[model samples]
Target: MARPTLLFCGLLSFLLSCGERKHIAIWEYPEISPSPEVQDYFGTTVIDSYHNLTDLEDSLVQNWFKTQDSLAETYFLNNDLTTQFKNRFHELEGRTSGEVRMIRTDEKGNYYYLRYDEDKDTDVLFYREKGGNLETELFDPSSYTNEKQNISYLEPSYDGTKIAIGFDPQEEFTSTIAIYDVINKKFLKDKITHINPDFGEIEWLPDNSGVIYLYFPFVEKSDPKYKKHSFSVVYYLGDNPEKRTPIFGWDKTLEIASDYYPKVKIGSSLDSYIVGYAAKSGIFYDSFIAKITDVKLGKPNWKPFFKASDKIYYNQGEIREQYFIYRRATPNGNELCQVEIGNPNFNNPLILATGSRENPITQFEVTKDHIYFVREKFGVEISIFKIDNQVNITQLSPPFVPGYASFFGESVAHNNIGIGMDGWTSNYIRYCINDEGDFTNESILDSPQFQEFKDLVSKQIMIYSHDGVAVPLSLVYKKDMKLESNNEVFIYVYGAYGESMSPFFSPTYLDWVKQGGILAFPHVRGGGEKGEEWHTQGMKELKYNSWKDLIACTEALIYKGYTRKGLISLYTNSAGGITAGMAVNERPELYTSFIAEVPRMHPFGLESATTASSTSYIEYGTIKDSLECLGLIQMDPYINLKQNKYYPATLLMPSNSDDRIPLWDSGKYIAKLQKYNLAETPIIMDIDYKSGHENSSNYDAAMDVNARIFSFAKSNMRY
Candidate 1:
């Protein structure tokens, strides 16, 4: 297997008078013998030449990836810009006290959370007492195994005597759940394997004697149904996991589809009933309620709580004594509603709180005395509100104004709540609200303030899209920076699955702004920035709105004198690649370069018989339907690439272990781009072998990746 070589042409000066420079290098891409394949969809024939790359077992494919990786290594070897970004990243990250998340509080006021361990370079589980000023180390992957592992999920028991922790070794999607005795300070004999920490819930029983969790039947990545057909099962303490039968899932009930994911939810305050829900990759869910006693006796009678047609939001509902509180999609907005669990009537439920288009309810949690929910005003400002037993709504004042806030780990038994808040310019801090509604700072660690971030400013503006739709765009830059077209700009986009691009503090953004670069975030239609309608407008047949909205925002920025056409870069990861890829394909002259990390570049490939295809057919649309097939073809970046067209320099980053979006997707896209690109700019594919879809757990490794991205964007700037 011969590796590709980089042919460095003579460096041409673009703006030597202004002291700005760029290297002109022509890269010799790896030679691939494409095995042409064709597929017919509703009388439309599509030809794919790089289809052989999908076979991971092919030696030719493996060699090609290795050659491409070597080419990237040779291109970035000892580059001064890369080294400068790496050093600045280290200086910025070292000043902070790491990060803390997944906070859970037990009934006895014991706090459990995952905190970053600077020495081990991984997040470790820590336990803090009610009034203690110090945190005690509870669980570290280094203590149990030599392999680097991460704490995927944590759920403390109701009685505070035991806790369940899900650990993913080496960033593998396959996780295992283990029980730890809080009082005894040791791990129990109970262990459940073949669990996915990202998809479902891990609920503890009311008596603390058992746990119900989502389990996957197939663990081998080679299996066609590797991440499909997930079901919920109960695991008793010290019992054999193989002997347990599923209490809710496709096999247990005829109501659930084989491809849909099933999960179980048990309220800590209620010992009588449990909730079971099944959903694909959409906001709507089909939910049912069953008695706990019947479930234990192995004759669970599942009664319909709500159907997908009812428009109930998944993972947004909580079970109270005899009532189920949830937020449902309405024409106005997402309405907070409650229904009787015994006789669930979703058609005419009791509306506790109603939201408008201007302020849509985003998240909610049910406590013993009240129900708390968070609302967002066009994805910019966040507000918290509460509803009492008498259905009286009141807005609660947070510690900070115009910041992101959400309730987490609310104990129904103790009526205690944890609120995590942060802004575009503020560091994340946690607050504990007691039963009497008093807020107290319960943060276990404090992040150091940097002068670079202190001098930064953020502004929210609305830009009209191609369809005359107003889309929210966020801008962050140095306070002293002027709106000059000469400045470099970076746009980050992720508008899919009804997820919003919310405000949060990050040192990486500050680093870019501190270097006199502007960062832009567009709240496109596919996201839940406005409401459910906003997401539906950009899905399936209307998916083109997402990329068009991004283009509109970018054009508006340039017209407003924020940055010039050739000085801007587009950055997107995962599903956001759809927007960025299509935007670049439509208007390549607007950007100097673009980076796609673990992106889903080929929508037609997603229709193949894979786990992602089955689970995500609802969001991306299935080829079984003619209309949806047309929509998928329209948004397909790989299929839309024109021959001999001028394109910006592109850096495609694909991780070897990313099961969500395999490396072959990026490999095929880059191959086509490199073959047809008319510009002298390079189309590079960088591979990360150790990580999956998520970033690396090792601090230095993650920093190195970020530095490469920053440097790559900087190197391509025309200036």
Candidate 2:
């Protein structure tokens, strides 16, 4: 059963009887006045025609969206090809799920996890005790609110009596944090509201008295400008839960040029430790150590732990014994360092693990006897290693696995570590390391039959970019498939925020490959695949390199006879959406179909918007800067499209509830693109009202979205 608009059952019936694409009428777009807004940016005159569309609440824009939805509904419902693709994707998705594995284990031997119940068609949170036979259902998000609301973050207390869970209403940026009592399976009266949707890092005190969390006062102040600053607050969770005392923030008396509140993290063992980075930049940080024996006794004397300079960026660390094992960013890669708890001099900190271009520590975790870390090589493969205080490194995991592994959630005591891992040909699986040092793994959900992929082959290959850089591409396809230009291919890229799109398994991608299509993942610049140097090469003024790298990957695939022009489709979301939008705008001829989910389209328009966050300015510099302005204009997909040019069959998927990048961003971009495109190819804006930047883990919701996307892809292809 599905919504009337989705027409799930009707489409299934149509799919079973269909043989060819049906003639569906494509409605003409609603007429809107060409209200151009001109502005002078550093002596450059920029013209914006869809300025009126930016007002998402405007009657005109709302009416336009309704009309577009009506058109899409009619076109998709009537087209037999749409039904066919939906059925195929639905079947494939039914056999697999994006199961949320229990990422953390508490000292009390409790393992908290989330999984989709196929019978219920929703995701449910469950926790099992160390020796318990039955798994207890902690939270069923669907029961709390509508299907759209899901548990975005869950952190259990050290003692396991309480747990902090963040509930995110789909499409909205803010989340509601509530404390839950484990034994009773009930929520406490205390609720912490207005958390930053992107960053909800919270640390519970060892005493279980309160939590240390980052809070932006935008909701309380109700001022748009207030969003620029976020401070750390200690909220005691007893009878007086209302008392939220600020721990670290704006000391106006201190004559410092930086923002008063930067992103900070707190941890405690023998003492409390905090690592803070200037919010203005994601790079460097300052550390403080305090004896937080009593969280309710106001504040304690904070001693200097390590004063971070511009050169070193603190990732994460913890205080164990008298030494601190922390990870810091180096020139080439991130390294693990050991320092005294209250070390006044930071220069003499001992290097526990020296990181380099060849062996970069992507992530690390602290244990009593040993420090466990993941080192990545060749930008795709990762291996786990552990080192003791004796400076001896031992390989815990095999040198190579099919996919990469990373920290899944908060770790529990007893040396138990949970990891989330997947590969191009692999399904998402959860692995656990027991106290005895044995690695155990289980599929997150009932994965699709792996036997189907026995004929498939996946590997990583290098392709030279425009600037002679060897960009890596991860590809998966049927081994017996002919390497001909006729083969259909799907390419994905996201090269921003130094966040790499790893070679992970996807049922959607596997469905395409199973249908004789090829899936290629371009490990382009702008991502941390090759470390910070690769990221810096494609950021700010050099942002074009990201899309350029994607284009180069496309060309190389075509040249190698994996696919031909007009046979390949590209997909990306968020920052990756920026990469996809830019690539399609620059080289429309290289692709037949393009899908951008919640894309960062016009940087100038985005920066000028009232809803834009000040913290985002660091990624793509402010508009006031001349070079940044020029780069934003050059990369603006809406502005760069040529009039009367034939673009690819484009799908712009934006979540109506997504506050991160407002729906209007995609709305305005689609409107401008539709006006400029004279070709018969479709430019569709598929808006999901129930999803957000982080899609739901619900099984049905996943099926619905995949059906829509895969159906569109199927309709655009030539048989």
TM-scores, one per candidate: 0.95, 0.90
lDDT of 2 at 570: 87
- Encode model 1's per-residue lDDT on 1-719: one tens digit a residue: 12244343332212222322477565567889878788888988877778888887889898888777766766566357777888989888877646777778787788898887788778888889987988888887678777656677788888788888877545467778888988788898888787776677678878877878788887677877777778888878888766666788847444577667788888674558988888678899888888998888767888777888888898888877788888998767699988888787888999988777767888889888988888898887898887877888888887786558877767566577788888888888878876556678875657577766888888889999998989999999888888888989988999998888988887876788888899999999899888898889889989999999999999999999999988998999998988899999999999899898899898778775454535666888888899998898888898788888989989988888886787888988998998889997868888887777865446777788888888888888996
> Positional deviation of 174 in candidate 2, in angstroms?
2.6
Predicted model with the maximum TM-score:
1
lDDT of 2 at 73: 63
**lDDT tens digits, residues 1-719, model 2?**
12225222221122212445322324256567768899988888888888888777787788776555555565566666656666766676666554555356666656777776766655688887765657778888777755446567788887788888877544445678889898899889988876763564777766677887777666422356545556667888865655677665544332223333444554432345454444444444455555665334656454445554623555667667666677776766777787776553456678878667645777887765667888776567778777766888877764237457876433313455566667777666666665445567533334456677768878888899999998889898998889898898888788887776677776667878888889889988888777777777877778889999999999999899988887888888887776788898888889888887777777668877666654455666678789988877776777777887888888877776665677767877788888888666778777776766666535555665666666666566643
Model 1 ranges off by over 4 Å: 1-21, 250-252, 435-438, 609-613
Backbone clashes in each candidate structure, one number apiece?
A: 0, 4
Candidate 1 accuracy as lDDT: 0.81
TM-score of 2: 0.90
